[model samples]
Target: MKVRNDAYLKAFGENLKQLMAKSNKNAETVAALGGIETKQVYRVINGEHSATLSIVYAIAKGLEVHPKELFDFTFQE
Candidate 1:
């Protein structure tokens, strides 16, 4: 089944993509750095899955940024 991409997830994914671009990183690199599967990174980036708090922390760690920055995007929900 195709997963629904909520506004929040979409916004988060966009923010992640932007950060990845800025840092010259990709899903594989982020996954390695975050200690997650590359597919997991893609799923989050594609808005196909909602990451857990731990995953968010891992992603932030991978990006070398504060977790709050990942959720800095404006969203209605």
Candidate 2:
């Protein structure tokens, strides 16, 4: 089956990448801070797959931001 990431997921990924860029940290660094795998961070950032709610929260926690902030996206997807 051919499946694609949902619009909201894609939007979240874009927002995550932007936040990561603004954090001035490398993927490895963010992954460590996010308590996730480095490859997973890249996968999410690259939109290879949809991120789970847990991941969303984890990422926000890693960034020292509120989960609501992650949802503050332009929703481009």
List per-prediction Cα lDDT, in the order shown.
0.86, 0.74
* lDDT score for candidate 1 against the true structure: 0.86
For residues 22-65, what per-residue lDDT tens digits would candidate 2 score against the true structure? 87767787778879888887777777767788877777767777
Candidate 1 accuracy as TM-score: 0.88
lDDT of candidate 1 over 1-77, digit per residue (tens): 22334877888999999999998998888889999888888888988789999999888888888999899888665
Which portions of model 1 show Cα errors greater than 4 Å? 1-5
Candidate 1 shows a clash count of 0
* Candidate 2 residue 44 C-alpha distance from true site, Å: 1.0
Overall local distance difference test of candidate 2: 0.74
RMSD of 1: 3.1
Candidate achieving the largest lDDT: 1
